[model samples]
Target: MGLDTPRPRAAARHPARSSPPRRSLHGLSGPPPAHERTPLIRSCHMTHRSRRQRMHPTNTPSRRADSPIESLWPHRYSGVMISIVIADDHGIVREGLKRLLEVEPEFEVCGEAKNGREVLDAVERSRPDIVVLDITMPHLGGLETLERLRNEYGDTKVILLSVHNDPTFIQSAIGLRADGYVLKDGRAEEIVTAIREVMKGGSYFSPAVAKKIVEQARSPKSKSSDPFTLLSAREREVLRLIADGLSAKEVATELSISTKTVEAHRTSLMRKLDVRKATELVRYALRHGLIEP
Candidate 1:
């Protein structure tokens, strides 16, 4: 159902709960225009000069000893380096990726983050061309983070790195139009290949992930439509807030909209999900992996 569903205006009888600062989907009120919703890519750089220096310790020719001189001179004239941000919860994992990608003179490790929020911040500041992100993180999960990145920062490509190979996770990433999906256990060369493929306007999935997609295509169970496709972006945002235990008034305040508008969105969500109660909505969200249990 559309978010245009209407509900009668009611008086606010309860108070909005105090909540920690979090990202808002539609600025705090009604659905913002498409152009206004996605942030403009301002030219900015991450202030991690010292940290990046620490990541690459040597200044000698031995680092490039194995590379042919012919390959190194082309990038200098082209003035193009594929910028990347590595987002992983583990410091060691980030370090490993940074070092691996740094070996390629054409690739630059521009920034790094430990969680979803930090990832957002890093991307905004660095304006990296690509983001290599872990699938599971605290504060926000990878799937949700991918949605935000696609919506708000449309220019950057995202590659999901995960330990899980479940069909649900694989399908979600594909639906979200992720540029690549690579398993953490895969060989280092796979990541390099994925980066190159995605940069060339192509997509890549790990061998195991590709096999899962093929198996899913052959299975009858894969034909079922995802219920999430039925809800509009605004309705989905309202559902997430409500599932997070926010009251209608609180959701209105958080979204910068009137209570009547929030109520209308809720009504539309209920109608679309075929649920009658707030608890049922929460259950639907949990079942669909919209919110944590």
Candidate 2:
């Protein structure tokens, strides 16, 4: 055999190794398939976002977030017009309210009332969803109307439109569970916003009124402003329970007394407090710390 040229050893067989696929912003040679990609993409994105935020600190968010009230009143999705009854003692005021509300397509002026009596009648006849009430109406006031509405027409909501910004008035309306409170001097838009907010099952107060409430909460209380000094401890307890929205029978049950006794205490407290109605008593209780608003 011609000295066989030593056969060259076959190159050692080896598996081909592939390089990692490169990411392409222009999608020419696109990123690796999902399963083959590294898991750090999300982490890289988050890191970039954190650096951007640190470079530009913003006081207000770029987009306004949804308010707590936005979750309420699913009926809003149904697109039903919110019916409203405007109740003010002054004809001029009622006319202005009617004019203001008429412009909003979402609202319907179901009725107008001069006083609390007419308000009741209007509510019975029209069955409006909301009542924009004046605090100082004759015969029955806003708080009284609110109380009766709570007792009789549980579905109807009330918003107190008033000139008064006193803490006692604010506390009273809140205690009676008025859905909204707006100052007469505030912009007309405020009333509209209040209506929307209240219908959303949220309370709204004028900015000034809210500020006053905050300041009062931070300030020291004076003995002279303490309404509790006018009543005995027993009377105070009864008022407290009543202000808590307990009926006479309920109060009696809670206090371990007869309903008659509860009624007597209520009457006595009303007279001593110079209040004519249960709503007024509740407001007094709220203002004096006999009960919470």
Candidate 3:
């Protein structure tokens, strides 16, 4: 199925939602060309001065230090010296995220910037342990900043939290060596979970974001589809239907197969996909773009 894309039209920002797209230098509404996006990002940094946020210096070098924030985390993780900088174009979103981070003591919102330019200056001065960046900030979007940041400061870990769940976007970040990608719709607690996971040297992706990439990777266009490709043709058929929200009986009726056959196919599919339950299989199928909702 073709992916449903809601374009970033400034004019379409609903009554209670966001802003209209600014008059582009060219007087158009679409995003800037790919190459221009990078330079535009640098321009944002070049224009900013000082930055601010909820950050305070940490006493411990490793993450084992107990900060007030770490104790409050949903999961008890060693409060590492995880200095985080926030860069999003929306002030409301940035503040909300800061408040959410306060839920867990393991994270420190060291600096905040409303645009890409401010982010660059904050990075130079803050030297944070991690940077939580939004994909489309004014002056410089996330992708542009990410490319430059990775090229220059290889030490910093970047976690992108954006509305965009495009596999292309995730692959681009992964290609540039970004540490993680989380989605904006994720619960505040999951964001903290992602931060801690990345701090612990594990890569994290929001369930949705991860699914997109995994789905793309399993597409026929990819070569090493072995793990996911092992599904028998019937298994694949049943898997796709199940993920699309059909029950076993429903799937059986549709495919003209017995309920027992559907059950067996589901079992084989689960084992092959390395997923445990129906939900995980759904996630796997969603990742592979076999399902959409």
| Strongest candidate by TM-score | 1
In Å, residue 262's CA in model 3 sits off its true spot by: 56
lDDT by residue (1-293, candidate 2, tens digit) is 35877767887588777876653322215644454332221111133345345334454232112533334432222223567889998999999899998786568787899877789898888777789998766445566667788788887888989887777667667666788889999998899889988877788999999987787677747322745444544566677778878898987886568999988988888777777888888787667544434
**Which stretches of model 1 miss by more than 4 angstroms?**
1-79, 223-293
Question: Which ten-residue region of model 1 has the weakest summed lDDT?
Answer: 35-44
Question: What is the C-alpha local distance difference test score of candidate 3?
Answer: 0.67
Candidate closer to the true structure by TM-score (higher is better), 2 or 3: 2
lDDT agreement with native, every candidate: 0.76, 0.70, 0.67
TM-score versus the correct structure, for each prediction: 0.56, 0.53, 0.50
Lowest lDDT block of 10, candidate 3: 38-47
